[model samples]
Target: LRLVNMRFECVGAIDLLEFNICNNVEILNCDFAPADNDVVSAISTVNSSWLTIRNCRFSSPATDNGFDYCLYAAGGSNKNLHCALIENNIFDGMDGDGTAIHIEALCTASQTVIRNNLIMIRGAGIGIDDDSDQAMVIENKIFHNGGTPLDVNASLSLMNMLSDDGTVTWSPTIAGLSA
Candidate 1:
């Protein structure tokens, strides 16, 4: 399914788009806003692959004090998922404890890419709980957040990057802390 240039508003803690066992789904140029929800999210995908969420906007309550997530994607323990991408999106007015993007531990995302995103938040930024070996988080601008910017729970899962020519090498950091 493809959701493009659409608007979705939620009055409660319900996901705007939730899917499972599906593939090749794309959500682009969409607007998702939730009103006064202490717990909710805009997108939630489970056990799916080839999912792309790009050029989208998300807005949540500014007074929420509980768990409120913007996007939640999981693949479970088995990790059969193929690929997922979140890029060129904007997140704003998030006011809660949860992260803007939460990648669950069970998800073994083979090729998960989160890049070129602007995250302006009043809460946490992003969280990756799984060992996404092929995960690439590059060039994301996260600021004005009340909580940490990034969190990777799978300590050993964080990989070192080396250029194809093997000249450049770098490692990921968790909330500005060396990994």
Candidate 2:
């Protein structure tokens, strides 16, 4: 773990760090907030490999939230093991009212790079279920979500450039872009 700066509060069910089975691991510039632990999986790597999380910031747990995943991985599916590189992280205010990043159900992440992150919701910013494949959710800026910003049921074809508007969305029929 190459965590820099640093700030973590009310943590539980933790995976602020986990490089299971293990390989090249590095989580940099860290900050985790308000965690309570809601386990199903939290950074698993029964047979891990090259993992990297940069500029980290996973939040929300002090009193009203729990983690399903702030980062996760699991048993290798069969072939070229788990290869990860999560970049520029800032998954804010996770409360399990919104799950946060989970890539498991049998791993195979190649050139994985979830870029420019800021998942703002309660339950999902990333999730790749069973038999995972080439992963890369680019330029992330996910939005207002009590849920469902993303929930990949996992096949070899999940793609996201998700931008849920970042917050000024309520068009009851025109007159707001900053009228």
Candidate 3:
């Protein structure tokens, strides 16, 4: 499946886009704006492989409860994501306990690449959270988030990244990051 050059505005749903058991999917140059504060995610994927999301923009409203994510990818017990590439996207206006991008339950040693993105959120949320150890996060600009900019569970590599928390701009050095 391929979705290109589209605009999704004021979409009132749990997930504006959902993909399950899909392969070779591409979403490019799209814009997403959730309706009010009732939306959960802009895009969600389950058991998908070889997915690419690039050059997209996502915006959310400020909510008390806070939504889940701008983009989420999850694999089941039997099904696991093989490879996913998310790059050159912009995620903004997220608040509370939400995440801009969340990747979880990937296959062992499956490589997921997150690079060249701009993520800015409010409140105590995360910019990127990867449960898999095989993620490569590089060249992302994260600003004004109250929580961790990049959170990886195990050994992953992060390079050429910039993060700011309104007062300080610094590069985080992670232990066990491979060269």
Candidate 4:
């Protein structure tokens, strides 16, 4: 219940912000726009923990629907979301499908930390489903997306720490990432 520097604009497919079982929830410097185009999720948290979205800005509904996720952290009955920190956020234009950021936990989500964000989206980027565990995606700056910025299916130690210092950019290329 601690929303700081708030600015939420919703006209149509609205869900500018949603919460549940609030813990240390802190959304700082917020600016979210869910202006129609159906399929909504500007920011959503179910079974919340130490959820902290920093320096935020998100705008969804560009093309597709299926509820474009600007930021959604939904855990299971165990409410596994812990130590969550989505840092320095700036997830721009996402308009189709989904996956600007979606963390689905069931068996894991112990130290969920997605760092230094700046994603210019088209849909599908950063999805940590399949029973998330010690997820820590670091130093992010994804561009012009069409899936696969970091889609870890989780389990079996899928701790892919991608660091070439390029900050993740892919325009037309998608095959293995790195452009």
Model 1: per-residue Cα lDDT over 29-72, one tens digit each = 99888755654667777777888889998875564632366777
List runs of model 1 lying over 4 Å from the truth: 65-67, 79-81, 123-134, 153-179
Error in Å for residue 155 of model 4: 9.4
Per-residue lDDT over 1-179 for candidate 2, one digit per residue giving the tens place of the 0 to 100 score = 35567665544554544544666767678776554544333344555567776887766544256455666566444532356677777776555453556655456666666566666665433322223545655545566544566544233223344444444432121344342
lDDT-wise, the better of 2 and 4 is 4
Sorted by TM-score (best first), the order is 3, 1, 4, 2
TM-score of each: 0.74, 0.26, 0.83, 0.28
The Cα local distance difference test for each model comes to 0.63, 0.54, 0.73, 0.63
Q: Each prediction's Cα RMSD?
A: 7.1, 13.6, 3.8, 13.0
Candidate 4 overall lDDT versus native: 0.63
C-alpha positional error of residue 49 in candidate 4 after TM-score superposition, expressed in Å: 5.1
Q: Which stretches of candidate 4 lie over 4 Å from their true place?
A: 1-9, 12-15, 20-33, 36-41, 44-69, 72-80, 83-99, 102-108, 111-120, 123-133, 136-148, 151-179
Clashes of each: 1, 9, 0, 4
**Candidate 3 residue pairs in backbone clash:** none
The TM-score measured for candidate 4 stands at 0.28
Model 1 CA lDDT for position 87: 87
Between candidates 2 and 3, the one scoring higher on TM-score is 3
Residue 60 displacement (Å), model 4: 4.1
